[model samples]
Target: MHYALAPRTFLFSHYFATGLRIATGIIGLTFLAYFIADLPTAVAVAMGALCTSLMDMPSPLRHKFNEMLAGVLLCSVVALLVSLSSQVEWLLFTVIVLVSFLASMMVVYGRKAMPLQFAALFVMMLSSEAPSTPLQALRHAALFFAGGAGYMAYAMVVVWRLQRRLKQQVLAEALYELANYTNMKAGCYDIEAGLPAQMEKLVRGQSVLAERQQASRDLILRGRPTPDEEILVQVHYAMFDLYELVLATHTDYELLRQHFAKGTILPLLGDLIGKAARDIEAVAYAMTRNQPSRSNVDYGPELAALDAVLRDVPVGEGEDYDAQAALRATANKIRDVIAMIGRLHAATQASHGALPLVPHTDMTPFLTQQRYSLGILVSNLRWSSPVFRFALRVAMAILAGLVLSRWLPYTSHGYWTALTIAVILKPSFSLTKQRRADRLIGTLIGCMITAVILHFVHTPAILIGFLFVATAAAPAFLSIKYRYTAVAASVQALLLIGLTVPHGGSGVSERLLDTLLGTLIATFFSYVLPSWEYHNLPRLVDAVLDANRKYIDAAADLLLKRTGDDVQYRVSRKRFMDSLATLSAALGRMLDEPADKRRAPDELNRFTVQNYLLVAHMAALRLLMQRYAENLPAREVETALEAMFAEVRASLGAAHEAVPAQAAGQSTWIAAWPGWAPLQRRLRLLQRDAAQVAQSRTAIGAALGRD
Candidate 1:
């Protein structure tokens, strides 16, 4: 019963809800137009609504409005141009090439421009399906704008109404991912699990967590929160602090496994951490439903049992001392995690006592900044630019597809071929290959489903219902999973054509064939001027190094009491995380490429893991200082921290430079005080991780031919 509820929580997620809302607006507007006016008007309005909906991603209310507005205007203009040129074959072909290149080039502006780019291309394909006179073309473009504007207005109202709820949903999503990350971290405590595989999964999980945290930042920190939204703001802050604590839990898991191989302590620790993950997941579930957390799992017994077992373990010298200290440190961090979870639940229940003060500094720097300037696009118009190469690749594929469609028999709906090309071909070969597979599989399944429905069910009402479901599911599943999106999109397109056109269902076979053709063309062109991930390794590695350096500098300042957790530190940390995620994602793509194209796979993997460990160690060091400041030698600790920071800096320096074998010998200062054993151990771990990072960097540089 407990496991059953978990699936249900995800099934009714915010993504699905947003999909339903969009479906409601689009179908509602289309049907009303069809009933009150005519089918043509309804079709125009639906096209406009659908194109504009592509831009309706999760963002701030103001940014959402502006983005949707841009979509409406750009799509409308593209429709008008396509309509006007459809009468002349050569002119239409020329327009297709120019439009494809320009639209694909919009990627220079980053992720935010992707939907707008697709919207323009989508409208062009739709408008080209029917030729129009200059005056009718004007009318069609106007209706398209009207429909987009209407949907935009409708969407803004819905967002405004559910603004707070949206914030909660995004925050809950981050928490849920954090919970998953914690569960994965628990696997490290299992003696049977392979540490290398576990670390790989953890790195991938970090990439996902970074993305979720950014989304939370964009939504929760966009503008000043009102009095009612203060609790959410506080929860948002607490969630990140909790994430740092989780990172700080990274210690010598292998060492612990070796020491506790025959005992029950390892399993006990894993069980405790796993339960904490579930507790977090429960809170996230409550947040999604806007209900107070009703957590039933009591950690008291588990904590007491773990404490009793740890009390029985002998605290001897050397390895025994290190193992015991690592275990105790992990247990203490788990306690901190549990306490943080309580605070999170309290915030949700509106208990505001002792909430952390929200940062008053400008939060804009923490949020990702996208510059929408023509200079960026123009600057990318070079052979070396990935965007330029991608644009050319897309345009060429479309042109080849067009020529093949003209030559092929029974190709009445050739525009589908072009549409498939536009959708499938991407800048990277990995994405193009994935999309090609999804498109073919999804189209095959959707066509079969639609055929079965059309053959058996003759009720117009049932067909319309299917149409609504498909329309809503397409956009909803787009971000969740592309294969699902492709299936729903295929069904929606076929149904709309069948209902509005003379013989839409009859083209199911043609749809499959065209998808195959598009896939083939896209696959062929993917190899043309492809921007391999290996080519970017130098820059990505440098970015990881630079971000880690800045992050360590900020962390050191905070540890030494020179700064608070100000915006600067937060920004540095966020940037570091972002860079790590970028590098990790790039490496993933590189691995997916052909084996010959992959560079430094082992070295890059090690570099990423070591960098991750370096950050975690620094976080642990900070927590150690906070916990033992009163008992330790303050001056000696500060001096040692400075030395440790220098060691890390030297290790992370340019790959060509020589790094010291040992920058700060721990025995010089750490041996003077046994009371600071925990801090001393953490410092030694930091130095070890830094040295490993340097080694990985040198290996990566050698593989890339940079050294």
Candidate 2:
């Protein structure tokens, strides 16, 4: 599993910024504890830094601060509560179960809050043994909270001093992703490339692009200067134009091969377009590095040569309409794309400008319901909601874990069992199972390392220093590699245990035993009314169908010359892109399910594959329309195409309604696309693809009968 690196994704500057900041926070706070308070007091302060690390998500300074602030309160509150309730085991158990349920439910609200919630849970484990007394516990929480605040302050200073550099990094990443998107789109035009697979590749790039763009926007919103903001708007405008060009670049490989089967020129043109896309991607790279763009290089000579060749190519008339019309449309689309690329290249090279306002992004905001509202809670009570099902499953699992720990007469580490359940048990069974395996494997390995460390590392200063390093590395690797994160955390746990209570609880074997017990309980309880992906598949299918309908509607308008405003076109494309991503993501989750739980995977796979192919065909027709520019289709041809798109929509609309119950049949979305007329080959290609979709849906319907 190779990850794509952005221009400066793993540069020394980033490493220095992240590693130095974390190391400073932990080491400074740890020493302050040793000199100003006891080593245990220092440990408390160091524990506060855990919240700081968890909030190390790559976000703007403003968002980062708020997240850290929330972390401080969550950890402090959870620590205090655990400390206060420790005298009564049952009360503490109840608290863990309730908190676990609520925390696990956080993702349904969105990804923004999940990390903070999990981090708070992790800190609660650390603070559980802090102080038995209320006053001492409060002091411990305060010290830990201060440790977190110190880390946040250090971060604030870094961002404040290096805002532009940080902003550049964000912008660079966004531009890099845009380049990848363009290249993937270009790949689809290559005659030999796999359409099904290329579209999947395109989806991956699009998701990454969306993430980077959001990060860039967040930076722009981080109280930057007006000029900085205008610069961001320029970057945004460039990407917008890029997408419009992408929309206009629609092509069908089969048609391309058919129309120019005997020609070297068409294939040469394809190769040239691919080269142009690469050059555009190079421009994106240049933007990231703050270097002058290669877009300044003239494209006129190469394109002028191609134009001479095209002008000389015979427009064999009458029966050769398919070849002539397609060739002309293809040439026009490529020409326009080349022009857009040059414009973007020039825009990227220019450092200063009175940037025009690009339209605002169609991104949805972080949604929150009334915090204390019973209404929000009540609304999620249905069995249909994965969130509700997950909450119940987690609540049950946590309660069972608490019981298991207590029922075992010899194990004193009941909290370890609870922590394991909290960390490993996800709403989805496959995900929970994966985490359980990771938890156990990571725990066993960590325990072995812990035993060796305890045997050889006797110097207190060295141990503290090692703890500092472990603390700094864990959260940094948390998203990159969860296995590493698991190891870092386990090492921290063992180090703290050896440091604070060496004489009383020094055995790594006991920690391993508790981890084993927790893994079993989490595994067993994961199936307590698990939220299977099968339950959610219908909605995903519905989303795909609906997005296609809207895209076709917008494309029909473009073809008919009803409107040239790309606002609807862009919106429809976003919906289609977003839906494709979501459906594919769900399919991946479905693959992770137990064999018995996956009712009709082949059907789901076909649904996805056909949708990808159909969308590609749709893009081709749109491209021809883009090339047509101001010329409306002949009135009769325009009416027939509009009718074709409407019937497709109506057919899919029926399929969508019938999907959840597994009652849909093949679509009646078939029309020959005026195959005999003087219509464009692009429309005929769309017609063929749409018929295939209807047939695919029928096959899918047969496959989904089990549902």
Candidate 3:
């Protein structure tokens, strides 16, 4: 179980976030009641939260408006169906459940404006509560829509501010990562292990920057292209290439380390690596600020140093030769990268910040197969036993609520009990635990808030108004922080306490009793007959290893210049990512379990980071090879292909440990290198990918278990 530290900053942020949410929640809740005031408040509260939960935080304003409009229209139609089918309550409930599931499935599949989650929750709200009248149900639906709309407006303003803050924050973190890379040049070489995190963060940063660019694109469109955009893209591409070079360097380093005079060449290579890192940092900083003042200053200096180093570097005949030529080549790549950065800087400054357009054919042909396969993988997973788990959890919550209502003095108090349990009954174990703890605490806080209000003012309508404010604002406030579960529990507490006014009882006694009951029931059901066993990490391990095998096969085929059948390649890539995601989640769950319960004979399953990079490198190599293969000269390519085939066969034999050292150890690409087709230029790319996959498979097998 993960421990929740009472970090002072998080606590402070939670409170401020709560305040904002409460304010919007009140307005939203009140707006829902504005048109139709006959409905029970419970249904409205659940639907409101559901709406906020399903909304994408970064969706465009216009897109949100359209989605919300569609949601309202859909909900309205469903309300009509409920009115007609009210005579058969059981039938309606079944229909509601079915509708809810299908709509949610659609959301997951379509990834469209409409969120199936809202529709499902809306159905649940209506069917579970069994609203007394058509007007009452309609009123509840209206309030739910109003609450969601109000919070959405608030989210728009708040998130816009947050996005701006993130830019500076992430940029600072990127610079720090750059510094770390520069400082680690002399450490053990392990590119797949070492540089993946840095590159991943850069990829995420670029995505965020792209969002920011879109935000300002309209205004900047009339102006010339911004040098910043070009510089940023150039930076992005350069980082991509740098990451690849890092991987190649790691391989080269390992090879050299095995036989070279480390005392002679390692020092010089390390210095070159350090210098390249410095150049990267300078370019990153310049790109982040979109400033050119330091470009010529930094770029020119790196190029001068790189050129001097290359001129002095010594060349050797073989792969094992301990010459500095490879180091010089690496340095030259950095200098050429700097030249590209300079071009971007000039282009950006000249174009008023517009992006430089590259005319290219659609990557859709190559990437579509992979993308579609991934979609199917996600869809298949969603339709698995997890769906049953979610449904069962919902049923259990409803049962617990029914049981609690029997003991409560009032029905409204029981509603509170049930809602509380549902709030904390998350789909997974750790989430359930975290929400349970937060639920208990938030309930106490809500009780205190109501008690304090009761002491100062006793009017029922005033109490209702306060509860409304608390409920509506909870979602908006929780929107920004990880304090959502707590905020939600507190909101429910306030609403339930206000509901007690009609029954004429002091809410404190009922509040504590209901909270205790809800917590106990939720905790019991969560552990009893658990839906998934995190301890059995072997299941995930098995899947990952199988996927790794397929990935190896895909690399081998691609390396052989076999792009004729792309389906296997597509399947392999898709399986690789899905398995990776599964492994990541499984590892997390395994780590969460008690020490004895954790599976996987050893920590061998912890190679997720390395495996992920190896997969990426494989994909990149395949793409490069495909591009070259598609343009090869027929006759020349045929002869070169035969030669490459022989080397591949030798490597494969050696991979199985079935080839003699004399034959397998021969140089594979010496003569096949510059001879035949355009595709031959990228044949090395394919070979590198295949080599990494084979090497990684061996390393992982050694680390985990030999198959």
Candidate 4:
């Protein structure tokens, strides 16, 4: 048995891999038989099928694929009609282009963008130099449908096995975040920076899982993971617990900082805070791994000990951490979150479908602020003036594409240039830059893969099989966050090479030429659009100011404890968070901009990070102030609020300009307002923190360093 363990193990693993290959081979053989009468015709149909599958790999990929399919189908139908009427090439091309553009645009700006993408490709196919009789065109359309349907079936088979795995990953991430949040409150250090991003991913994963489940039902639902799906639904509830805990942490930290600034507590708490941050980071790392979570490390007794130490420690002010009862209230808030996590975890084990829609918390503010409706086509286009924007971007892209096309050795390179322009003319600079980089890298890698495949397997059947594997792997890879980079890279490679296969490229050099020209055009248009520069310093500064205003206004309302206005306050805070996210995105775009086009913001990205942190601090302060405000008289709090507001305005104005630090420990806002020592001291701390945040500018340095 020990003679050659590695070789034996490899062979064992190979058996399973080989089995899958055989199964796939059988599927391909069956499809091959249907179109055996004409090998070239069969090959064309197979190629189209493969492209559809590959394009459908990512969850979001469907929107693009659907648009392309719809567009293609529509164009094909129209072209068939026209072929029956007339055979003039110029007239056919013109009609196809007009119809396709209108159809694609209808879907793109409509509720779904998937159909529009298909429309574009269909239009291209119809208008291609290859002419066909009406019957022939109709046959091509039927082949396209057949290929599409075959791949759809293929997806159902592969995704059924994957659904369970994806469900487990999603649940584990949600649970880990929940656990980490609870641990942090017990004076432990734990930070999961990826938690927020993971939330977005999990939401998307759930959507996909739902779609797959529906597809499975249509195919033969007996094989689907019904029990696992139920558990996954319970897991979504567990996620609510995690979100609440994080929000509590934000508010708690604000209170903690204020308590410390009062100069009443020892600095011993800082080490514990740092430890909590470390613990959270560790938990985040664990969740990302495929392995099971480590057994719970119960720190209940340790927390009790820490609580005892805090109670015994003498304060100059002789006030407890919970003296104003703010800390205790925050602790209770965190406990509520912990209880929810515990209950949800139990429910997940029990296997449940939908839970009772208990109004545990109001998310109206978060939703209203973050999600913007694109509206119905006619209405949205009327508002956005889509035709005008489209023409402007198209013209810019065409200009850039033409410039790159001139340098390409092949005249056909212009088509890729047009495609490059289309991809680059998105709504935002950051998106354009990301897509450009992704497209270039994907194209390069895909072309190399195609070259290797052509050398080894020249036949259409083998090529189609290869495409199936690529397509199946795409969605699985794109399911996780870290894999997105590779997903984009893989997708670009596949799409470019897939499209070129029918054209019968001369060699690798020609393929490379097309890719390079496409990349050049895409990258060039991304920078030269002369649109609103996302990373403009003034815009960044303005965004920071706006976010600050929203945060302050929300914090004030929360502190006042106006229950009916919760939705408005949450909405305002959500807007503030969005603004911070926008600023971060802008910083990324600035890094990608051409050197000459990239202008440094006045204070740089330091201002952006500071503003972000400031908003978070304000959130925490709102939570703390509301709890603490409960202990004081209503009149006293109102008076203090007015004084604090004045101080914030003055401090903000002074810090608005970049200036050298002065050690006078002067007050920008505090001096202007006459107030009690406690109120003045609290306001002073905010000014100090805001100034420190604004003055620190490491983000810009980090961005430049990456270059």
TM-score, each model?
0.96, 0.79, 0.57, 0.59
Per-residue lDDT for 576-680 in model 1, tens only?
Answer: 878989999999988878888999888998889999998788778777777766657777788778878888787777455766766544565456555478877
Quality of model 1 by C-alpha lDDT: 0.84
lDDT of 2 by residue, 491-582 (tens): 87888888887754445777788888888888887777777787777677777878888888887787677885666776676667668777
On the 0 to 100 scale, the lDDT of residue 630 in model 3 is 44
Please give the lDDT score at residue 217 for candidate 1.
89
Q: Give candidate 2's TM-score.
A: 0.79
Candidate 3 local lDDT, 326-396, one digit each (tens)? 35433444444345435533542454335444333332322212111345435544435554455455555
User: Which model scores highest in lDDT?
Assistant: 1
lDDT of 4 at 203: 27
lDDT of 4 by residue, 1-707 (tens): 11112342222221223224323533473357455756545644553444344334222223333433543454445545544433664565455445434443443442334323433443343224256676766776566556555655554455445545434443443343333433334331112223333333322232233333322222221222364355444445445434544444442344454454443232333333333333433333343343322324343653465577557645544344333344444444444444544454354445244454324454333321112134544453442453434434545554455455667556554545455555445545655666666656655665676666666665666666665555434433332321333343344344335544654545445645665676666565554434445335455556666667666766666666655555566556555655655555555556665566565543454465445445545544554454454345456556566556555554455443553343332333333323223343444455565665544433443433444
lDDT preference between candidates 2 and 4, better one: 2
Q: lDDT scores for all predictions? A: 0.84, 0.66, 0.48, 0.46
At residue 389, candidate 1 shows an lDDT of 97
In terms of lDDT, the poorest run of 10 residues in model 1 is: 1-10
Inter-residue clash pairs, candidate 1: none
